[model samples]
Target: MTSAAKPEADQTVSGQLRRALHPGGWSLRGRLLGQLVALVAVACVVMGVVTEVGLRTFLLDKLNGQLAGSIQRVDSPIGGDQGQLPLGPPTSGRLRFLGGGAGTAIVVIDNGTVTDAYTINQQNYGKPVKLPPDALAAMETVQVGKRPSTVDLGGSLGAHQVIAVASDRTPGRVLIVGLSVVDINSTLLSTGLIMLGVALIAVLLTALAGELIIRYTLTPLRRVAATASRVAELPLERGEVALSVRVADRDTNPRTEVGQVGSALNRMLGHIANALAVRHASEMRVRKFVADASHELRTPLAAIRGYAELTRRSGDKVPPDIARAMDRVESESIRMTALVEDLLLLARLDAGRPLRRQPVDLTQLAVDSVSDAHVAGPDHKWRITVPDIPVIVPGDEPRLRQVLANLLANARTHTPTGTTVEVAIAQLDTGEVRISVTDDGPGIPPSLLPEVFERFARGDSSRSRAAGSTGLGLSIVAAVVTAHRGNVTVTSRPGHTEFAVHIPSED
Candidate 1:
C-alpha cells in the first residue's frame, strides 16, 4: 500500500476499535450493568482455563506413571530368565502378565531388525494381534531411555505414549512399551465441556443479580433527578414562586452516594426557596412604593395642570414667552400624569390584582381606537379590519379598550407620516380572539424587539420623543393582557411591524 493509504487504513482500524470499546449514548445504568457482566464473564473464562490446564496436567502425570510401571515390569526377571524376551505367539501371554491393557503396542528390535511386534486387543478376548508394519515402524522411532512421548500409529492403533529401553540381557536388543492416551484426551475434553457449562451458568446468575441490585441502588438518584426536573419546569422568573419541589426525606439520608446527592439537592432547593421569598418581598415593597407614590402624585399633578390652564385663560395680558412657558408646563404636566397613571397600573398588575371579567366586543374596540389614532395622528393613514360578526372575549371592557388604544397610539407615534396603520381583529377557530396592529413604516430596530413590551422600552430612531410618548404604552398593554390571561407578541423587520394579542374567548 502507498504511504497515504497506510495512514487511512490505520485510521479506519483505530476508529472501528474506538467505537467497539465505547458505544455512544449508553445510559449510566446500562454501562454499570454491562461492566459487571463483562467482569463476571472474564473471571469465568479465566477460571475455566486454569482448571482445564491443571486437570490435563494431572491426567498426563497419571498416564506417565502407568507407563513407568509397565517399563519396570518389562525389565523385571520373569520365569527364572533374566529379562529375556519371550518369542513367538506367547508374547501376548507375557504382556498380559506384565499388566499391559487394551490398545497397548509392544515392539522388540534386535540388531536393528524388528523380531516381534503385537498389541493387546480387548475386543478379541485379550488376544494379541500382530501389529501392522506401519505401527512397528512408528514405534521404532521412539527415543531410548527418554520420557514417554506421544506418536501416531496409523490403522486403528491411533496415538500412544511410548518409551524405549535397552535390553539388559541382550546388548543389541531394545524393548518398546507404550500405553494409549486416548482415555486421557477423552477425560480432558469432557472436563472442559463441563467447566464451560458451569461457567456460563455462573455468569448468567451474576448478570441477573447485578441488574436487580444496581436498579435498587440507583432508585434514590432517580427520585432526586425527578425532583430537579420538576423544579426546572416551574416559572421562577417573576412573582412569588412557591418553589415547593424537593427531594424526598428518605432519599436525602446522606449515607450512600445517591443519598448524598439527594441531600445536597434538598439543601440547594431550600436556599432557592429562601432567595425567592426575599425576591418576592423586595418586589412587593417596590410595587407598593410605586403605587403609593403615583397615588400621591396624582392630586398635585392635577392641580398643576388645572392652575396652568386657569392662568392661561385668565384674560390678563401675558407676555408671549410667559404664555409659551405656561403652555409647556401644562403639556409636561399632562405627560407626567400619563406616566404616573401607567406606573400605577403596572404596580397593580404586578401585585396580581384580578381584572373585572365581562364579554367585551373587540371589533368595536378596534374601530374606536383607530378613530382616535386618526384624530391624534392626522398625517398618518389609519385603517380597521374586523369581521362582520362581533368577536367578544371575557375580559374587562375598560382594560381591553385601553389595550387597543395603547397599541394604536404606539403605532401612530412610532411610524412616520403617510404610513398606513391597519388594525385587524378576528375570532380564531381555537376559541380565541386575536387583535393585531400592523404598520408599513420603518420597523422597530432589531436590537429592541426582544424587550419591546418591557416598561419604558423605545427605539431611539423610529420612536420620536416629540410625539409625547410616555414609553410605557406597550408595557401597559402587556400587563393588562397578562392580567386577563392573554399573551402579546411583537414582530418587526425593515418595512413591517406587527403587535399581536391573543385572548381566549369566553365560550
Candidate 2:
C-alpha cells in the first residue's frame, strides 16, 4: 500500500483485530492465561538458576575437601626402594585413586626439581605427566606447614591447588602435592545443560495446559456473546417488536461477569419491547382514524361538489365571481377525494390487505397507460417501447395501471414541458419483467432520491401543490408494486433520471 492507503489498510486490520478479541478491548482470556503461564515460567527459571548455583557450590566444596585429604595421604614409606606407599581403601572402583577420586592428580617436587607426578581419570591405572615451568614457579610459592594455595598449573595439567608438606621419611626433602579441578567444572556444566532443557520443556507444557483450562473456563462467556449477536440481527425497528431472544440457560447464571452482562441485556431488551408495543399501538390507532375519517368524508365531499356544479349550471343569472367560486369549490372537492382515496389505499396496504391476483396483459396495460399519459401531458413528448408478443403478469389490472401511470405522470409533472419521457418494457430470460420510465430533464436532487417513494416527500416547492398532486402518488406506486412481490428503484443525476420496476412474469 502507498502512504495514503496504509492508514486505510491499518484501519481494516485494526477492525479485524477488534472483532477477533473479546469486548474488553483485547483478548482478555488470552491475556489472563498468558500471565498465569508466565508466572510458572519465571518460577521454573529461578529454580533452575538456584539449583545450578547450589549444585556447583556443593560439588566444588566436596572436591576441595577431597583434594586436602589426598594431600595428607600421599607419603613415601621409610627405606622403601621407590616413592611407594601402603595402598588405601580405594573406594572408587573404576578409578585408581591411591586416596582420591577419578581424574585426581598428585605431584611431588623436592627442592627445585619435580620428584613425582601421577594422574588418574576413570581407570585403575595411574599415568605420569611432566610438569611445566609455570606449575613449578607457582608451586615454588607454597611453604611447608602453610595453607594449600590455589594456582593455575598453566600448560595441559589444567589448573590446581597445591600443598607443600615436609617428607616424613626423607630427611632433606620436601613433598609437593597438586590437585586438578577440571572434572568438577565439567560435571557442573553438563548438569546445568540438562536442567535448562528440562526447564524449557516444563514452560511449554505449562502454557499449553493453561490455554486449554482457560478456554474451558470461559465457555459460558462465548455462549453469552453468541446470544447477543443473534439478537442484534433482529428487525425490531418498526411494528411490534417481539424481542423474545434471551441468553442461553447455561450462560444466564448471575454469579459470573458474563452472566451479569447477559442479564442486563435481557432486561434492556424487555423494556425496549414494551416501548415498541406502545408505539405500534399508537400508530395503529392513527391509521384506523384516518381510514374511518376518510371513508366518512367521501359522501359529504361528493354532495358538496354536486351542489356547487348544480348551482353553477343553474343558468339563473348568477354573478361571474360566484360562478368562478363554485367552479373552484368543485375542483377542490375532486382533489380532496383523490387525496382521501390515496390515503385509504395506503392504510389498507399497511394493514397487510391482499391485492387482486389474476393474469393481466402487461403489454396492453402499458400501451393504455402511456396513451393516457400522452393525453394528460400533451405539452411533453412521450414514447413507449414494448415487444410484439403479449407480456402477461399476475396482478390487479387497475392497480398495476395506476403504478405505471403514476411513474409517467411523476416524470411529466416534475420535468419541463418539452422534456421527453420514455417508457420501456422488456421480459428477461430469467422469468422477470422490467419496466423503466426514463426522462431527459432536470433530475431529482441527490438528497431526495433515497426517499422519493416515501409518503409526502416533496421537492422543488413548485410541484408541492401543483396539478393537484397529493405527494402520495409515488408512494402508492411503490406499495402496489411491493404487494405484487416486485421492486422499484430510481437513479437521478443532472439531466438524467430513471425509475425501474421489476416483477415476476407469468407463463
Candidate 3:
C-alpha cells in the first residue's frame, strides 16, 4: 500500500478495535485485569522501600540516643591526661563486646598532643590515625560525629576510617570514638535482601491469586464460546440446536462483548431457520412445476399422433384444404416435440447430468466449428484464430462444442450477410483457458443484458415470425459453465458483440 493509504487503513483498524473493545468508553475486561496486577506490583515496591528506610532510621536514632546517655554518665573530664575511661553498660547483647574488640577503639586529643586515651585492645587501639581532608573539614563544623564521619587511620591502620565523638557533661575536651560503617552497611544490605526475597514471594502469590480470580470470573465467557463453536458446527438442515441451545441471558447489559455475541447468535439462528423453511418450500414448488409440465405435454403429443394417423387413413378422400390442415397439424406437432426436447435438455442440465470429460483440444474444435458455420451460413465470412499449439482443456467435448456452435449460430442468424464472426482460443495468465466468439453485428441492448441467461429469455423478443427457436440456448450455456465452476461474460454494443468463456486450466 502507498503511504497515503496507510493512514486510512490504520484508521479503519483503530475504529474496529475501538468498537470491539470500548463500546461505551469503559475499561475492557482484559485491561482491567492487567491494571489490577500492575497496581499490586507498584504498591509492593513502594511499601518495601518505605519499610526498609524506616527501619534504618529507627536503628540510627536509638544508637545515637544511647551514645548521648553513655557520655552523660561519665565522671572523667573531657581534656584530662591520657588514660582509660570507665566502661559503660552494654548497649545490647549484639553490641556488648564493642569496647574490647579488635574492630573497636577510642582516642582523645588535648593541647595539640593526640593520645590513645581509652583502649579497647592495646594492639588494635594503639594504631595511629589520620582524618581525610573533607571528613576533617566537615568534622570541624558539626558537633555530633559530623553525622557518621569516615577517616583514615594510618601507620597500623588503613586508608579508610570512621570517627565518632562523645563528650562528658563536665568535659573540657572531646572524646572521639570510631568503628567501621562497613559492618553496619553489610548488615543493612543483608536485611534488605531478605526483605526483598520475602516481598518477591508475596508478589508471586498475589499474582497467581489474581490470575485465578480472573479465570473464575471469565468462566461464563468460556462456556459461551464453547457453546457457540458447537452450535456453529451444527448442520442447520437437520433442524438441530433448538432455541434452548441459546446462551444464558445476562440481563440487558450491552456493555459486554460476550453478551453481544450471544444475543447476535440467537438472532442469526432465528433468521437461518426462517430462510431455510422458505427455500425448502420454493424447491418443492419447482420440482412439482417441472413434473406437472412434463406430464401435460404428453397428452397433446398423444392427441397429435392419433389425429395424424386418422388423416393418413383417410388419405385423398379428405378435402384439399383439409389435407393442408393435416400438414399444419404435423408442423405444429413437430414444433411441440422440439419444445419438449429443449425443455428436457434444460432439465437435465439443471439436475446436473454427468458429462464425459477429457482433455479436449479447444483450438482444433474452434477451427472445425468455424468452418462448419461458414458452410452453413455461406453468406457470412467466418474467421477462426487459435494459439500456435493446441489449447487443451478438461471438459466434456460435446458440450464444449455445443457452446461454440450456439454462439456461432446466434451471430449468423442475427447479423447482416457481410458481417464477420471471429473465434479465438488462448490461455489466460491465471492458468485458465479463455474462448471468445465475437461478431460484427448490431449488438444487444443494454437493458436486456442482465437477464440474457435466464430460461426462455430472448434478446430480440419482438420477432414478427415464429422462428424455430426455444430461446434456451444461452441459459444452457450458463448452466454448463456453472457446472464446470467457471464463468461466461458478454460485452456488446452497436456493431460489436463478444461472448467470452473462462474455465480453469486444471479442470
Candidate 4:
C-alpha cells in the first residue's frame, strides 16, 4: 500500500469502532438491554453505599462505649508526682476490661509527655508506645462537653475511637484511650467487595434476560414485516399485479399491537390489488382504441395524397388557386399520417408485440440515419463516426433503423438551424452496443429532462413549433430500444445534450 492510503485506512477503522461503541447508535434490542442493566447497576450501588455507612456508624459507636468504661480504672489524686497505674480487679464490670483484646490501647500524658501507656496483654510498653500525632492534634481541637470522636492514627494503631479527658490518677495531666477499628474496617471492605461482585452478576443477568424477552415479544412483528417485504418485491407497477400475500393467522389475531399491524397490512394490500386491476383494464381499452383507429386511418390518408398528386399530374385546365389548395391538403394529410403511424407503433410496443431477432450492423444504421438527417435539415450540421470493426447487435432491422432516425430527428428539430448534431456507434467491453446522439445546442430545460421521453412530451416555450414535431420521436426511441431488450437514457446541460441507447451485442 502507498503511504498516503495508510492513514485513511486507519481513520476508517477508527470510525467503525466509534460507531460500534456509541450508545445512541445501538440497535433497539441493544438499547433495551443496556437501559435495563443500567437501572439494576444504579440500584445495587445505592444499596451498597447505605449499608456501608450504617455498618461503620454502628461499629464506631460500640468502640466509643468501650473507651468510656476503660476510664473508670484510673484513680484520682495519685498526682503528677507518681506514674503508677491504679491497682484493682478494675478489669471487672459490665465492661469486660479483664479480657480487653489485643486491639485496645490506652495512654496517659503529663505536661504533654507520655508518663504511662498500656495495651491489652500489655504489648509494646517496654519499647515505649506513643500516641499517634493525628489523635493528639484532634484532641487539641475538641470543645468542652462534646461527644468523644474518632481519629485516624498511624501504622499499627490504624483508626481509633479516642477521648481526651483529665487524668484521675494525676493532676495537670491528660488521658488518651482508644480501641483499634482495623477489624471493623476490614470487615466493611470485604463485605463491600462481595456486594460489588453480586451487583455485577445482577446486571449481567438483567441484560441477558432483557434481550430474550424483547426477542420473544417482537417475533410476531417480524413475521408481519416479512410478509410485506415479499409483496414489495412484486412487479406491481406493470401489467397484472397479483397481490395475494397476507400475514399469517397467528400474526393477524388483532388482540396484540403487532397483530393489529399485521391485520392492517393485509387490508391495505387487498385495496392496492383492486386499484391495480382497474388501472390495467383502463390501459387495455386505450391501447385497443389507438390500434384500431390508426389501422383504419392509414387507407384514407394514402388515398388523399394519391388523388392530390393525380390532380396535379392531370393535363386538364386546373385553376392556380385549386392547385395551391391541393398542395396544402396533401401536405397536411402526410403530416397527420405520420402521427397516426407513430401512435400505432407505440401502442403495439406497449402491447409487447414481438419483433424479428436478426443480427443488424448498428454502425451502418448510424451512418444511414445521419445521412437522412442531413437531407431533412440541411442547414443544420450533421456528422457520424463509426468503428472500423462492425458494431453488430440483434433486433429487427427496420425497427432499429427507425430508432436511430427518431433520435437524430429529435436532435435536429429541437436545436437551432445552425446547431451541430453527431451520431456515434461503439461496442462496449461488456459486449453491448452503445449508440449515442449528441448535439451542441441549447440543452433541454432541467425541469423537463426527467419526463422528456414520455409520450407527447414537448420542449420549452422557446422551441419552434414550425418544425411540426409530433413529440413522439424520443418516446419511440425509448420504446423500441426497450422492446429490443435494451435501455435508453439522456443527459443535458447548457450547450450539450446527449441521448444514449445500450443494446446487447450478439456473438
- Candidate that scores best on TM-score: 1
The sequence of per-residue lDDT tens digits that candidate 1 reaches over residues 1-507 is 001234343358777787656747466888888888889889988988898789878877888898887776765655634544443474544332366678787887878877668887666555567888888889989989898889888867788888898977667878898788788888878988898888888888888998899998888888889999999999999999999898888888877788889889889999999999999999999999999999999999999999999999998999999999999999999999988988998999899998888888888888888888899999998988999998888889998999988888878777779999999988888878889999998998777787778877878833356667757888899999888888998888767889999999963
Identify the runs in model 1 with alpha carbons over 4 angstroms from their true place.
1-24, 74-97, 103-145, 149-170, 173-178, 378-381, 461-467
**lDDT by residue for model 4 (1-507), tens:** 011234344358778899889998898778888888889999999999999999889878887787676565443333322343332332222111233456666655678765555554235543323445554554455442357776676656667666778755566667666677788899899989999999999988888888899888888888998998899888888766677888988998888898899989988988898899999989988898999999899999999989988888887788899989998888888898999999999999888889889889888888888888999999999988899998888789999999888888878877888999989888789878889889999988777788888888887543544566767888898889988889999989878899889998963
lDDT of 4 at 376: 94
Number of clashes recorded per candidate: 0, 0, 2, 1
Ranking by lDDT: 1, 4, 2, 3
Model 3 / residue 200 / CA error / Å: 31
TM agreement with the true structure for every prediction: 0.82, 0.74, 0.48, 0.79
The per-prediction CA RMSD against the true structure, in angstroms, equals 7.0, 6.7, 11.1, 6.5
Point out where model 4 deviates above 4 Å.
Answer: 1-24, 61-97, 105-128, 140-145, 154-156, 163-177, 208-220, 296-325, 417-420
Error of 4 at 385 (Å): 3.2
Candidate 1 is scored at a TM of 0.82
Q: In candidate 3, which residue pairs clash? A: 78-171, 151-161
Compared with the true structure, all predictions reach lDDT values of 0.83, 0.76, 0.65, 0.77
**Candidate 2 C-alpha error for residue 436, in Å:** 2.2
Candidate 3 per-residue C-alpha lDDT over 261-348 given as tens digits, one digit per residue, 9 for 90 to 100: 7777767767776677777667656745775686578688878967886786775587788887888787778777766755665666
List of clashing residue pairs for candidate 1? none
Who is ahead in TM-score, 2 or 4?
A: 4
